[model samples]
Target: MKEITRIIAFYETLKRKADVACALAMVVYVEGSSYRRTGARMLVSEDGFWEGGISGGCLEGDALKKARMAILKSKPELVRYDTTKGDDNQIGVGLGCNGVIDVLFIPVDFENENNPIEILKKSFENNNKPLVVITNSLKEPELLGKLFYFESKQSIDFLKNHLDVGLFSEEILALEKSKNYNIDNELRLFVEILPKPITVYLFGNQYDIYPLIELLKMLYWEVRIVSEPNKIQNRENLTIIAPSDFSENLLNKNSAALLMSHSLEIDKKNLRKLTTSTVKYIGMLGPKTRSERILNELAAEGTKIDSNKIFAPTGLDLGASTPEEIALSIVAELKAVFSGRNGGFLRERELPINERNQEIFKFN
Candidate 1:
């Protein structure tokens, strides 16, 4: 999310100067292990200036050359890099990543609304829900590099006559993550799902909240404060709301709340309101006993709290003692929770680190 935001900002700057000659390189498919997964993108200009990355710096130099070539030829090109080979001159030589990645470089057409960057910008404009992008990668020159953005059933219905509606609808419904689809050996489509940014609600006015806010901002997540607006500095992606005005309507499934006001009354009041919310993750700052007591009090008052969603004595046990270290621990735990992961040592995990629903569909 952060990388795409930077790419868009850079593209806008270039647009302002009337220098929109560039190419967008995106990792559309990956097999085995990769440093960056599908949907990772980089923008390259004719003069070799670039932003974002598709690899761990090993593939960017070569991707830059390929992107410039695509720009010059005014065509879309799919370049595959197999890192499993041990050849010294190979692109992934020494990385030992043991992956095959397919990158799509599309020359940007500023005049076309269906261009890659324009489609991406459209996705950002309405990010309250997931946006599905279909990129044609093979065979048809007119369709190649063209992007289809689907955020509504109306949009899907509009394309029913032109596409395999059944296959596309099934794939979109079953898409938990991004993948490439091969259609009867005639067409290849990269179906990318772009999710909305995570939102964090900090229900406190304490000084310790600043560190966590900074970390969330770095990740490009939205941060909101449910306390005194004047207590914190106003900045981008940060919203300040008064306690009286804070309501459950401001939260969604992608939202998390951290109660760190250091006051028992404030935490209890906020927790009560959050229990009635659809927000899944709620963290309370303090000792286990205190949080438990607060929950017990709430329970006695006819409020049933979801124990699974509550993280009392919030944050992973990182042996943190200082404010900054505690903030790091909290943010780390939040990431793990949202990603459906346990905050444990990565070396202890048996499966692949980036493994998920990665199955590819072949439609007839």
Candidate 2:
């Protein structure tokens, strides 16, 4: 998964910054079905530190215990988890959902030159991209890792060195675009580079935006506060703008705009501009009736607005009363839209439990 690649990148940065040695576990294959796919990685440290995951739940505890053992033993290992019912209840894992998973525990001492993981990780960091790591070609039809960069001539050589086979750049490019590669009898990994953080534009200096802005910063979102000259405070990632000072062309595709202006003229002007722009989400803080009145006034003045693109009441029905709670509710709605989730209750609905949860894939 790409998240795995990001975690590895963070590790690479950590090791360089703090001089800490780390280890990794790789999930190579699955029999039947598994919660996590092959190529899922878990990083563990000698000091009982850990980050990331291998299987959904079946492999974490064992992987951590074994990884700590690997740190003590100074050896790598290949481990398997069987979900089949066993004689002793404690002997093996019971997934409740059935499946068998095979994971390769590759321990890397960041200080060791012979470590394949360290080399592979370095390749990714140097290139500012993702590297594919192939595990098994026989008895497993899989590949793992994120596509860090587009397929390049250097990647062919990189693959040849790591996988022992000369894969062409054309196929690798195709695999990078697809985000997944099906290599015959091989465990394939394609790692993608991380994108920039999403930008949120808050178009008001109201007190409601304070907690919301704080919440956005807490989630590491890039926030720009578009407000009157004196209204803007000294805050990181914040910009104050007068009515005439706003720029329409510089908005990024992942940018979202919220119009919480207490002034009608300011709200109307921004609404007209944002309605015609490429912002993914344009939320206005008000009741549905107020929103309709604004739209009707705009329509009378010969401007068209897409109803689906605007969120009038601007949050999920979470019964929020406080500014912080309301901010949470709005963020929940934004997250659901960003992640392509339905934003519905699991217990009240008949959706499959797995579907309700954030699962990667479902074979059945």
Question: Best lDDT goes to which candidate?
Answer: 1
Off by over 4 Å in 1: 128-139, 152-163, 233-237, 356-358
| Superposition TM-score, candidate 1 onto the true structure | 0.93
Q: Write the per-residue lDDT of candidate 1 for residues 79-180, one digit (tens) a residue.
A: 889888887777887787889888888898877877788788877886623444345534555666666666655655744545677667766767776767
Clashes of each: 0, 20
lDDT of 2 at 295: 84
- Which pairs of residues have clashing backbones in candidate 1? none
lDDT of 2 by residue, 125-243 (tens): 56434454443334432322222343467655644533433344544444422133344424444333333357788899878898988888777677788877677665555666666
TM-score of each: 0.93, 0.71
